[model samples]
Target: MKISPKKTSLRGLRIFCVAAKYRNYTLAAEELSVTASAVSHQVKTLEDELGLELLTRERRGLRLTEQGARLFRELEPAIANIDGIIAEVQSKTAASQLRVSVQPFFASECFVPVLEDFTARNPGIEIFVDTSDETAERHPVSADASIRLFRQKPTQLESDALFPLRLIAACSPDFLKRYRKGQEFTPLPILVHTSRPEAWNIWSKATGITLPPATSVVRLDSMIAVARAAERGVGAALVPVPLSDNWFKYGALVPMFDEIAELPETFYLAYPKAKAEIAEVKSLRKWVLDLFQE
Candidate 1:
C-alpha cells in the first residue's frame, strides 16, 4: 500500500519503530523520554494510518505482526541512514575551517585591517589566510577561495568583482621636482614592476603621452617594491590605486601626470563552482564582497 506523507506523522513512525525494536512500549518510552501511554498512542496512530495491526499483544508480551515486521525491516535502516546524514550535516555546519588565497599586496593593505571583525563575527570558522606572492596569479591548491586580479571573470570558477584596477604614474615629491623639465617628466628613469615590464608603455599609450626616451629602467618583482623605490625617489613607478592611497596621501608619492590609466584587470573573489554552496566558502564570499565591493 502507498503511504501518503501528509497522512502519516513522522513522530508516530519513529515511536512505532522504537517500540517494535525493543518489543516494549515502556522501554521505547524510556529511551524517547516520553510516557508509555504516549508511546502506545503514537503506535496506535501509525497503525491506524497504515490500516494494519502492526503489533499484537500476547501472554509472552508484545510481538510484531507480519505487516509490522516487514515495515520495521525496511524502515529501520532508512531511519538509521537518515540519522547519520543529519549528523554529518550538523558536523559540517558547526565547526568549519576555510583556507583563502589572497594576493600579498591586497592582504597587507586591505584584508588584514578588517580580518579581525570577520573572525569575531564567525567564531566557529577557522580561517587560514595564505598571502604568499605566488597566490597573486592563481588560486592555491589548498585554498577554498582566492582573491586575485583577473582580466575577466573565470569561466571555470564562481567569481565576484571587488573593484577595477587603475594604475597611475607616480613619483616622490623630490623626484618630481628634480625631474620636471619644460612641463614634462620625460627623461626620468621609469620604475616598473618586473612582472609587467611594459606597464609604462601601456600607461603612456592609454594616456597618449610619450614616455622618457629609453632611460634606465628599474625593475622590481613586486608592486610594493616598485612603489617603495618610487617613494625613495629612485624613479617614477606605475602604481595601483587604493593600494597606493596612503603613499600618495602622506606625500610619499605623487602622481606625475593627471591621467589615470584604467586596466581591464580587476580584483575578484573566486572559488570553485563545486564549493560555491559550502558554508565556509559562502561566509567568506559575503564578507569579502561586502567589505571590498565598490
Candidate 2:
C-alpha cells in the first residue's frame, strides 16, 4: 500500500519520537507541553494512519514494538537534521542575536563573569542567555547553543568539553568551627541538591570519608541554593569546585576536607551540527574555549 503524505504527518512523527524515546506518554506530553491524552491521541492517530501497532502496553508502562523501534531509530536522526536545518535558516535571518541556553549555576559562576568582555568584543551580536535548569535537555531546539552539564558528550549534538566537574564538601566557617576539631570527621547535617541526591555517596567514594547520618537533611532544587544554604550554616553541601571559589575567597564557606570528588559529569558547549559553522555560534564557541583553556 502506498503511503500518502497526509497519512504521515511531521507532528505525529515528532510526538511519536518523543514518546518512543521516553517510553511514557505522560513524559512525552510534559516535554511537548501538551496533555497526556493529547499525546496518546497523536500516537493512536499515527498508528492508525501507518496501519501498525507502534507501542504495546506493558504492565507498568508502554514499550515500543519491533517495527516502532526500527522507525524510531531512523526517524530520530531525520527529525534532528530537519530541526538543525530550520535553526540554520533562522540563524541566517537573525544573525545579530546569539541565543544561548545555559545551566543556572554555570551561567552565574562561569559565563556571567566573562560576559561583559564577550559583549564588548562582539558588539554586533546580541547575546541572549537563557539560564534554565531544563536548557541542557532542550538545547539547539530552544536556543542556538547550550552550555550543559552531562556525564558524557550527548550523541545528538556536536560538543566541546569545557571543564571537568569537581565537587567539594563545604560549609560556613562558623559551621565548620562548630563541628570540626583538627582533622576529626564531623557528623553535620548534609545539604544536598535535589537533582543530585547521590552527591554524598559520590563524594564519600572518592575521598574515603563516610558521611554520618544527619539528624536533619536539607534538600534544595538548585546547586546555587544548596551552596547558599551551606553558607548560611544550615548544613554542609557538596558544590562544584568552580562555583565554590568565590564563597571560599569571601570567607563565606570553608572546605570540609582537602579532597575534592571528581564527578562523572563535565561541562560542555554544544550546538546543532548545522549551526556549528554559523558566525555567531563559532564566535561564542571560540570565546568559551578560550575562557576555559588550561
Candidate 3:
C-alpha cells in the first residue's frame, strides 16, 4: 500500500516523537497535555499507517524497536530544525536573547562573577539563566545551552569542557581550632554532599590518612547547603574549589588539610548539536570558553 501525505499526519509524528523520546506513553501524554490512552492510540495509528513496529514493552518501561530507533534519530533533528525555524519566524527579535541553563554551584561560583563582563562585551545581547537540576539531567535542554558537571560527555549533545572540579576539605574556623590545637587533627564530624558521598574516600586516598567513620554525618543535597553547614560549624565538608573560595577568604571556613583532590568529573557547556550553528549560541559558547581559559 502506498502511503499518502494525508495518511502521515504531522500531529501523529509529533506525538510519536514525544512518546519515543520519553519511552512512556504516560509521560508523553503528560507533556502533550493529553490522556495516556490518547497517546497510545495516536502511536498505534502512526504504526498502522507506516507499517512499522516502533516500540516494544519491557518489564520496566517501553523500548524502541530497531526501526523505531533509526526513525527517531532522523526525525529528532528534523523536528529541531523545524522548531528553530518556527521560533525564528515567530519572534524576529529572539536573536538578541540567549537562554542558558546552568548548575547552581557553577552559576554561583563562576558565571555570576563574570556575567557583568559578558553583558558589557555584548551590550545588545540579553541572557536568561535557569538553574534547575532537571535541566542538567535531560538532553535538548529547554535553553540555548546548559552548563553542568558530568563524569563523561553526553552522547546526545555537543559539549565543551569548562574545567575539572577541584575538591578540598574545609570546616568552620571554630571547628578547626578545637580539633587541630597544635597537633594532628582528628575528625569531630563530617559533612557529606548527598550527590558526592565518595568525597571522604577520595580525600582519604589523597592525604594518605586512614580516616575513621565520622562520629556524626550531616548529609545535604546542594553544594550551597553543604558549604553553609560547614561554615556554621556543622562538620568538615569536602567542597569544590572556587565555589568554597569566598567562605575561606572571608574566614567563615578553613581548609582542614593542605591537600586538594581533583575529581574525574568536569563541568561543560552542552547544547543540542542542531543548534550549534545559531549565531547566539556560537557567541555565548565563545564567551564561556574564553572565561574559563582566563
* Most lDDT-accurate candidate: 2
> How well is each residue in 28-118 modelled by candidate 2, as lDDT tens digits?
8765778989999999999999999999889878999999999999999898888778777877786588889888888888789879999
| Span of ten consecutive residues with least summed lDDT in model 2 | 133-142
Give the lDDT of residue 106 in candidate 3: 75
On residues 43-69, what C-alpha lDDT tens digit does candidate 3 reach at each position?
Answer: 899899999999888987899999999
lDDT values of the candidates?
0.81, 0.84, 0.80
Candidate 1: residue pairs that collide:
none
Candidates' RMSD to native: 20.4, 2.9, 4.0
Stretches of candidate 3 exceeding 4 Å from the true structure = 1-52, 59-62, 87-95, 134-140, 181-183
List, residue by residue over 41-160, the lDDT tens digit for candidate 1: 989988888899999887766999999999999987677566546545754766678888888778887888889999998998889998874334355445678889988787646899
The better candidate by TM-score, 1 or 3, is: 3
Stretches > 4 Å off in candidate 2: 1-7, 22-37, 59-62, 134-140
Error of 1 at 131 (Å): 1.1
Q: In candidate 3, how many Å is residue 254 off?
A: 1.4
